[model samples]
Target: MNKIVAIMAGSVWKVLVQPGDLVEEGRDVIILESMKMEIPITADFSGTVKEVKVNEGDFVNEEELLIEME
Candidate 1:
């Protein structure tokens, strides 16, 4: 089974992958900017990205689903 990991921080600056992209565990999927710092949201499991729930420069809240993998 696969899981979805959201951006834990509320700052979505860049989306690194698109739907149908193959992802590995610990790979950076999104880059977030908070307080002028960059943070990376990584994949929790090895799977293919099924969907991208957020886009580049989209403001997201904590625990907001950014990508779905399976």
Candidate 2:
């Protein structure tokens, strides 16, 4: 399994992947709102999404796990 984690502390603005979705390396998988700016978080590895750990509008700390891939 691979993890997609929040790059910074923020509220999750959008979730671009769900379980069973395909993802590519560097593809934006989540967008976070911090300091009123939209920060896109990208996939670190190309794989099928295994789980979505956070929901839209959920606040996350830096490095919190967002998605799992396999």
Candidate 3:
């Protein structure tokens, strides 16, 4: 299984990919708002998204699972 996680604690500003979306390495999956700035979270491996584990405006802690893919 492949997964994407939050790199820092922040509110989700955007979810760029959805379940069943084909993702490439280095694609931004989530954009988090922390300290008034948007931080994009990227995928390190190519995969198909299997689950969306968070919603826009949801707060996530550092290392929190954001998406599941395989």
Model 3 earns a TM-score of 0.98
Off by over 4 Å in 3: none
Off-target runs (Cα >4 Å) in candidate 1 are 1-3
- Candidate ranking under TM-score, highest first, comes to 3, 2, 1
Tens-place lDDT per residue, model 1, 1-70, is 4655555565678889988899999899999888888989888889998888887877878887788788
Candidate with maximal TM-score: 3
Candidate 2 vs candidate 3: the TM-score winner is 3
Residue 60 C-alpha lDDT in model 3: 99
Q: Residue by residue across 1-70, what tens digits does model 3's lDDT show?
A: 9778999999999999988899999999999999999999999999999999999999999999999999
The candidate with the higher lDDT, 1 or 3, is: 3
Clashes of 3: 0
RMSD of model 2, in Å?
Answer: 0.6
- Candidate no. 1 TM-score: 0.86
